[model samples]
Target chain A: MGEFELIRNFFAAAPCAQGGEGVALGIGDDCALLAIPTGEQLAISTDTLVAGVHFADPCDPFLLGQRSLAVAVSDLAAMGATPIAFTLALTLPTVTTDWLQAYARGLSLMAQSCRVALVGGDTTRGPLSMTMTVFGRVPNGLALTRSGAQPGDLLCVGGELGNGAGALPLVLGERTAEPAIADPLLAHYWSPQPQLALGQALRGKATAALDISDGLLADCGHIALASKVAVQVECDRLPLSSALVAFLGKAGAQNAALSGGDDYVLAFTLPSVELPPLLAEGWPIHVVGRIVAGQGVTLLDSDGQDITPQTRGYQHFRESP
Target chain B: MGEFELIRNFFAAAPCAQGGEGVALGIGDDCALLAIPTGEQLAISTDTLVAGVHFADPCDPFLLGQRSLAVAVSDLAAMGATPIAFTLALTLPTVTTDWLQAYARGLSLMAQSCRVALVGGDTTRGPLSMTMTVFGRVPNGLALTRSGAQPGDLLCVGGELGNGAGALPLVLGERTAEPAIADPLLAHYWSPQPQLALGQALRGKATAALDISDGLLADCGHIALASKVAVQVECDRLPLSSALVAFLGKAGAQNAALSGGDDYVLAFTLPSVELPPLLAEGWPIHVVGRIVAGQGVTLLDSDGQDITPQTRGYQHFRESP
Candidate 1:
């Protein structure tokens, strides 16, 4: 099939466009028209993942598709934006019908899971990479932002941390584990769920919120800098998944939780008194630290002693280890 | 410098962001927030241009930057969408301050000219390529689409048609011309202005509209398929810029006007009754053809004899000439 037919047959017919809200017009148009509610503002996010850079070369097309959209959608969740639609800019060296089908299936699965409509996209021949831009809606004055954190607020995360980072060795084939341990970690790497509901719930309640893509420590530094306050993380309190601790012992697991990336979990701060209500509702909110009247992020031990590591989290353009 | 610093100093500080409108939040956020007027809908379009495929490798980064964004914004114009904001997903081979500076300068210039704000983007190291997703605003239900054309409508185009295609020889370094002739052709190749105003004016007036990127004949086929009407083009009526004619001569310029690509000129159809006001208002509406009750596009010679070309316009993945 021609490039146009490939996109039309696979992407346009993907589950994301079968039936979704806010997509006034989909593919085969000069532009996709989207309806935004009168008083609501549109939340937009973009992410690009390149082969052998973001994921392993020769990775599963389905998993790659799922991971690509999931990570991009994470930013929408970070802003308390309800999933509405997305556009895919896919560059491939060549078109393989088998690969396209599998990839579209994975993308369709995630788009269905997130309830995000695939409204528009462009496909071109190039090195394998996917750039997805997601759109969502948020009511005015209620949207969460990184600059709203306040002193005396409690720091929290949506769920376990470092699983994706912990899964790195297995992902690269440097190590292997039983399916029991591998499945969860692989899912973390390939299909980490974006905390959309938690972010929506925290809106107007949490002072600040963001999805953790670049390890907890580095991402916390972002909140700190933007909010103009210090975030003290109690290393002892980091929530590590049992699967992660089983694979990488206690200290290793803690290290992963402290510095691992691509968890796609919600991290935020709210008044101390505001935590109980969210907890009582059975939202997997883990209290990991607190916001303080200072700048930057500080790591503290169980005994309240500073135990910051020698290195921070991942930074792009740095030489790979 | 760190990756964040590179983006902050280069892209975020570009002139496009210095007091642009409709962007509630620009770069440096998990997602950019945008506000739309109560009765308007968001028009979204994405285009990805790859090195050595869409443009030449080792070309002027400044020109590439300007042309890349200008072409994508052309789709917004084709939809009659007003300038709003855009997100850029830029992939580079390595971090070079010189290239980044020039590229950003060109992008900023185009963004400023179009009055579009750079709301959000991501930067990463990879093969040199750019994927730009632009957002614009359109009054609800007033946007133009390719499916609205009807029989007996006059086919019109905005401005000259073949300058870019006529300039291809210079772009590939296969031919050279005097500066007086070459400069304008190169400008058409490197920085063709999107017909934004004409497109906006044609919103409700034109039955169907689109910007011509692929040659006129192929793109016209698209309108015929979508609108289910036959289009008859009068070869003698094709608009050719003076610079194009000077470079390629009469017959060659007409051929280029009929089948050359990358013009970014608006091609649309409207009922005979709707043409007067737009033409009377001094819009650069060049009537090139008329719609009939059939399928596909037909070319007629000056003597009114059928003279359709054997080949159509450019198609991605098709073998290069």
Candidate 2:
């Protein structure tokens, strides 16, 4: 088949939202057309995930597809915006019908779950890589940013941290899976639920927000730097899943919670007055620390001891020791 | 420095448009904020160019940078939309300051030319590839589509074709270039001029519009299929640069124009009315053919003899004969 036929078979058949306010034409064209609302603004973000670097080579194509789109949509969530449309640029070594079907199924499932429409993108022959660029719409000046955290604001995170990172050993076959531990971790890593609703609700309520992809400490450092404040995270207050705690003792789980990446949880800051209602929702937010009037990040234990190095997360381009 | 720092130093330093209608936040954050205009729509398109696959591995980094962005912007052109914002996902094998500088320079120059803001994207370590997703705004119902061409509409193309294809031999060291032919052909291939202005101007005027990326016959076939019509082109009327004609001979140039890719020229159809004064303004447009009530594409020679090839442009998975 020709390029157009391949695209029609693999992508054009995927599910998409029909006739939305901004989406004039969804797919099956040279470019996807969108109609933006008068008072709202559009947020755009792009990310690339390579097979060996981002996921295991032999991983399920369906999960890879879901995770790829999920990771990109997570950026929209971090911005406190709702996903409108996304374009996928997929480079594959070869075309396989079985692979394509599974991949499309996964991508379609997530796209439907997030209420996002698949727009226009390119397919090429190359090393296995997928790049997704997601677009979102937000009311002008209401989107959350990383630069609004102030001193004394509570540092909070949505959901448990490090489930994805903790599951890596099992995914890579380096460790055996305990049913309780392995299932949740694998689910978190493979199919992250982007906290779009929570983010949109926290739009005006939260001072600063970002998804934790590069581990809690490292990602918190991002917010601190952007907001020009120090963060004092309490080691004891970190949220650890019961399964994670059971899998790896409290200390090990705490280490993973601090340094593990791919959590896809929103780490945000809010004033004390705005914290109660959010905390009342019981949305798994842990008041791990407070924003401070300083320049860098510091981790404080229950006895007020500094435990920084032991909890620092992974850095890109740095060799893992 | 870390990967984030390297990206901030190189890619993020370029100036972006401060306050566009949809751009609530530009760069330097987890995700950008955009405000979609109430009555308008957003057009999205993405493309990825890999080293050795899309362009030569040792190609000039500056040109590669320009061509990558230009090719992506061409998608916006095809939709007859106004350029607004873009996100770039860059993967590189190593951190080379010189290479980064050159590439950034080219990207910045093109962004300035297109009046597009560099919003937000990710940078990672991997094989060299660049993916850009561009956003544009179009009026509610004025965006052009490939399905609008009618049977009696005239087919026209902007600028000369095949210079890029003709330059491939020289770029690959298969042919030695004389100074006269080398400069123009190299410029055509390296720094392609996206027909954004022409495309936007043709928004309501042209029945169907698309950029010729996969050569004339192949792209026209897209229009034909989308519009449910046949296309007939006069071979002698095909726009051919003097350099290409001299370098590759008339027949060879014709072959290249018909079958080669990477020509970011606009191919559109206009109703049989005043030619829209495109030529008087020094914008080169050659009227080559007309849409007909038939199934496929046909080409006519100077003597009115059928001369179109059975095959058209490159297919991604197909082997070259």
User: Which ranges in model 1 have alpha carbons more than 4 Å from their true place?
Assistant: none
How far residue B118's Cα lies from its native spot in candidate 1, in Å, is 0.3
Q: How many residue-pair clashes does candidate 2 contain?
A: 20
lDDT tens digits by residue: candidate 2, A1-321: 666677788888877534434567876676898766667777788888987778888789999889999999998999898888888888888888899889999998998889898877888878888899888888878888999999989999988887888888888888986787789888998999999998998989899999988888998888989999999989999888888887778998888888888898999998989888876886666789999899888999999999787444775566542
Model 2 alpha-carbon drift over 4 Å, by segment: A17-21, A310-312, B16-22
- Give lDDT tens digits, candidate 2, residues B29-122: 7777665565667788888888878888888888887888999999898888888888888888777899988988898888888888888788
lDDT for A297 in candidate 1 is 87
Question: Candidate 2's error at B179, in angstroms?
Answer: 1.0
In CAPRI terms, model 2 is classed as medium
Point to the candidate with the largest lDDT: 1
Tens-digit per-residue lDDT, A1-321, candidate 1: 466677888888887777579888988888998999988999999999988888888999999889999999999999999999999999998888899999999998999999999998999888999899999999987778999999999999999999999998998999999999999999899998999998899888999999998889999998999999999999999999899999999999988887878889999999989888888998999999999999988899999999888666876666672
| TM-score, first chain, each model | 0.98, 0.96
User: Per-prediction TM-score of chain B?
Assistant: 0.97, 0.95
Which numbered prediction scores highest in TM-score against the true structure?
1
